[model samples]
Target: MTDKAGIHPKYFEYCYVAFVAFLLLSNIAATKLIEVPTPWTNLVFDGGAILFPLTYILGDVLTEVYGLARARKTIITGFALSILASLTFWLVQLAPPAADWHNQEAFEAVLGFVPRIVAASLGGFVVGQLLNSVVLARMKQRWGEKNMWTRLIGSTLVGEGADSLVFCTIAYYGIITGGTFLNYLIVGWAYKVAVEVVLLPLTYAVIGAIKRAEPAYSPQAWAQREAVRAAR
Candidate 1:
């Protein structure tokens, strides 16, 4: 019964809470459209993309600070939570609007969940996140955990590509033909990856700071070690 990481077990619980919150919020926020003054008017994106990239930052933190297994587990937890949220939202949308509600139409318009979209989202997330975690863990091992930039960006290339392509194709393929789907795919991929690129310095700072604050071979580490072992 040696203490893993020489710290309390509760921190792992806290990390899981943070991970779930970031993920759920990202999904909810993605539905809302907020216009920003980008160079291109047609290339609009939802607010959720802004926050969604932070999950990668979190991914980096999880792998760098706790190692790969814990990070992968967190990703899986996020995947399940995302699916649950989509299913719950779809159920909510199926219920008829009350006559007394003034904003029923508006609510449905914003909060509605389409099954195909949900499936695409869930599928893309699972594949992209799994790829991200695997690449990150292996990169960390190969690179001695020093080059944070290389790992974060490199993993995003694979993860974001999978996410953008799967989501865009599954969600909008037949609906948007020819160049439109391609544009959407490109925009989504670029926007998401750009967010990660911009956040690199901040990610490094946060990961470094968190690693410094954590203890070694405590419950969190043991839990994380177990996760990595399972993934391998």
Candidate 2:
């Protein structure tokens, strides 16, 4: 009978697509390593770092608005899609090249990396996304309708730390050892958390707008409003 959740057709559907898009893109991007400079030093990170943090943010939005059950469903969907994407790439990599096709090596150099990286990402993602969603959902459970930022930031801190550690370890543990390997863990985790913190204002705005426009945000809120109306 009515349109919902701002200009979006269905916020959950939009969020889910965006979540999986970023997830798959980040996995592909992660095949290459990059260095970020600070006045103190240069930090090594994967290309995926640029886009991966947004997944957690989107995860938060899904949890905060639609609740944990649906958020987890979305995470599983993204996870399954990521596996599908990796398998698709692997299949392409295995296919025999045409006699004139000379880019098979290039294809192996690039898309061939997808299976391993995507596998590592999948491991870390399931662990981290679940942690992030559980933390936010639990916080919302306790605080009711207040203190959104606390839960969002807190969850990111927990989720990103675990995700970065698992991913870096799986992706580069034996390949890059000692201080450099450890640096990957710290930098990746800290960078993700920093991105989440820096974007808190925007996060607040998005969540607020969604809550206002989406009627199903909180069953308790809806119940209380209906109770007040009954009194009137």
Candidate 3:
């Protein structure tokens, strides 16, 4: 922990809360596809890509303000929450549908995740999120805790890379052609990184403002306890 230990600012806590919210929403939204036509080719990406990069921004703030251990806990919290969400979806889908319910087919179409894909998502989240927090914490230690863009984008490169490779490989490897799989990997990762790059200014502003406004009451342990509570 930094010398600023024991101080958990109010706005900073809100940031942490927002981080987890974005992460959960992003993962749930990722089940859908969004396609667009570029000048040279048509590109397909998940809607979640737009929001997932915000998690990176939150990771940067946590590492910069609270330190790595806390960020590590936060990452773990996210991973556990994601798994729970997946399981909840699975359970809900498994429960018998009402006789009058007419949206069973549509609901299954939207959320009927295969076991392999679920495993891939959970695994990728653990590896990628940990790497992201670790890398950001290390960079912050070396770089004097400034340069939001460098840390945010740098960590995203590593984190999103792990996430993309694991997700694409395990979830769609045999289902998609090698060429198409590679394309999905590239576009998915690239799109997420681009979100970070584009939000550099906003990230800087948010970090700066929060740092100035929030009191330094560290919630390193409290955050962990809350995460565990949510998981259970």
Candidate 4:
């Protein structure tokens, strides 16, 4: 049978692996809040903020090159793996330490999974990633393949906005003041979007390379090919 929709790309597995790695690492890093000294002022943000944006970039690449179905699968896989990681960490925290182990407190401080934070992370991830993929797919359908920047930026704005708002509110509502929480939301959202914008050229190069290297998976591209085949 002919491969329709290019569902299985040559490099899809690699992308999936990278996506999951970024997601898991981001979750681990998010446990800490780091302060960055800037020329203008000190910036306080979660440690994950530095690397989490890469997931969105990867998400964009997945949706843009491999189509929404594949992107959705990757997103769901990442979500599941993240949950598994959290559960494993929680279990580890519960397990008794050896008598010689002197760093149990530090280990717990670093790896313990707080229920509220875990919920926030999972909830925000699902909402943000689903929205990101859906928006990019719909926008591609509406706009065709002409404007990559529009969809990337537009989707990131909405997707990251939802993610930041949900995560910050849920994770820090009681721990930090409302104002500070809002700042976190805004800063995180802006930083993520900015990361995508700054990396647009690299994104373009990667997408272009993937498109050239793989069979067409995008709905529009596949439909167009099918139409031509039918005409002949």
lDDT of each: 0.73, 0.87, 0.74, 0.83
How many steric clashes does model 1 contain? 7
Task: Summarize candidate 3's per-residue lDDT along 165-222 as a digit string, tens digits.
Answer: 8877776678666666677789989987887788788878877777666555336555
On residues 1-232, what C-alpha lDDT tens digit does candidate 1 reach at each position?
1134344433555666687787787666666545445566566455567667777677767777776677777888888877787778778777886788777667676667345555776788778877888888899889885787899999999998998788777766786777756767787889889988988888888776666666654476658768767878
Candidates in descending lDDT order? 2, 4, 3, 1
Off by over 4 Å in 1: 1-12, 32-41, 217-232
RMSD of each: 4.8, 4.1, 7.1, 3.1
Model 4 lDDT per residue over 142-218, tens place: 98888999999999998998898888878777877766666677778888899999999999998888888776655
Higher TM-score: candidate 1 or 4? 4
TM-scores, all models, native as reference = 0.80, 0.89, 0.83, 0.89
- Tens digit of lDDT per residue, candidate 2, span 1-232? 1222222324678888899899999999999988778898779899999899999999999998887887898899989999999999999989999999999999998889888898889989999999999999999999987999999999999999889888998887787888888778898999899999999999889988888776554575567656667878
Error of 2 at 177 (Å): 1.5
**Candidate 2, overall lDDT?**
0.87
lDDT for 146 in candidate 4 is 88
Q: List the residue pairs that clash in candidate 4.
A: none
Residue 38 lDDT (model 2): 83
| Model 1 TM-score (2 dp) | 0.80
